[model samples]
Target: MDAPSNVVRLPTAAPRKPNNHRFKEQRAAGYEAKQASVFRERYINPRVRAVMGDAETIMGIEQTPALLIASALFALADPDTQQKAMEQLAPGAVVGRKAHIQAIATMRRLRATTIGEQYDFYNAIDELEKRRS
Candidate 1:
């Protein structure tokens, strides 16, 4: 049988493996270490100091969540926004309004201190929202 003259053929290449191993190694060496230090310095230490203050009180079980809520609210820039976020996160919690007020006071006290990048704070809140869902 005679073949048609308009026939075309395409060439294929072998699939290449991803070079993700090197990327993981580099990230572990640099990014992870840097992130750990930053997290400890910026988030954990500050929250601990805020909760503990100069005089140490025995940390009760209930105090952990309270401290966390306060810290998250304090991270926000505005009182109304913090209140709204708290309301959204804990619809009927009694502490929502109180946390908002405390957050406002904290914000005022730390007004001169920089809060790092706004995007980072928003991203953290987004992640927390996702976890709640």
Candidate 2:
């Protein structure tokens, strides 16, 4: 009878702890790249410029349909006229009423202007119109 025994030992290194900061940074970079599509340069960035222009003008206010729904009670009138109306409708709410009235007045004034009559709402977004096609 013959007996043979073979033994093999492999050295194993201690398990290394993951670098939390680097892992987080890599994860953040991946998240940012994924979000890059959420903010397309030609779309969102250009639209941001349009939004800024909208914020400056009366037409900008019209785009906020919700505000109109609430404030529809107010009619377009000059400031003095609005003050007189406010004195009757909602007696102590002077400043707030004035703001609503002023918005209405400005909106009406803008409507009366020649530019208002000629405004092509879609043309503002027409980048192609800038070129001779």
Candidate 3:
């Protein structure tokens, strides 16, 4: 079967993954890389930029002097005064019960079939409020 060796031949390698499988793997890797890039661009980059900007702004003179003075005044205050101030700064109790009450009231005023049929359905969460109160 010997002939003139003038034709160029394609190179071959040992069978590892098939060509189609190799391409699929590469395509999947590319997709993951793109997804990571998009997430960073869409979320991480903006948040980092915002934090850096806020930090820079907070470091400026207007904020710096005020914070320093407040800290000094806070540190020098009497213990009871500090305790009262801290209590004042602390968040008060949530008014969720009142919100539910208002919601139930509003629902009662809505145009239901019997003008008050809405009370039964809307009053369910109100029971939770009653138990809590």
Candidate 4:
């Protein structure tokens, strides 16, 4: 039978109920997740209604491409260029070192892409294999 005399057993705790005891920030974020976003209502709707006379109007095919190109240009632009884009709200330099650097980088990337079109990776790999042998 049992020979141990110094061993002590303690009661185990129940599994943690994290959901039952969420932090204030976690609870607030959970509540926010259930709500619809007000982005269009706050920004897009007002401008669209003012210009087009309808907030429900769709950006048609012609406007869609222009919007896409504008987005791409914005993506390529630096912080200064992006700020100048919203010049009415926040005015600053028309161009800066950041803009110049981004422009040069974008042009270099474009040129590299154009050059990469003629590159034959399979042939290059074959040559590498021959060199290794």
Off by over 4 Å in 3: 1-63, 92-133
Best model number under TM-score: 3
Candidate 1 regions exceeding 4 Å error are 1-101, 104-115
TM-score for each predicted model, relative to the true structure: 0.22, 0.21, 0.23, 0.22
Task: List where candidate 2 sits over 4 angstroms from the true fold.
Answer: 1-52, 55-66, 70-75, 79-111, 115-122, 125-133
Off by over 4 Å in 4: 1-12, 15-61, 64-67, 89-133
Model 4, 78-129: lDDT tens per residue?
Answer: 7676555545322222344443433333332223233333143223333344
Q: Tell me the deviation in Å of residue 130 in model 2.
A: 11
State the lDDT of candidate 2 residue by residue for 1-133, as single tens digits: 3334564333674355555675787899888886777555344344334433323344334545765653453344455765555455543334556445545434443332455322433343343334324
Model 3 TM-score, all chains together: 0.23
Best first by TM-score, ranked: 3, 4, 1, 2
Ranking by lDDT: 1, 2, 3, 4
Q: Ten consecutive residues with minimal summed lDDT in candidate 4?
A: 52-61
* Candidate achieving higher lDDT, 1 or 3: 1
lDDT tens digits, residue span 1-133, model 1: 5537886433564355556675778877787678768465444333334433211212112346876676665665476765565456453333545444444434434333445433333344444445458
Estimate the Cα RMSD of every predicted model relative to the unseen true structure: 14.3, 19.3, 23.5, 19.4
Clash number by candidate, in order = 0, 0, 0, 0
Q: Rate the local accuracy (lDDT) of all candidates.
A: 0.47, 0.46, 0.44, 0.42
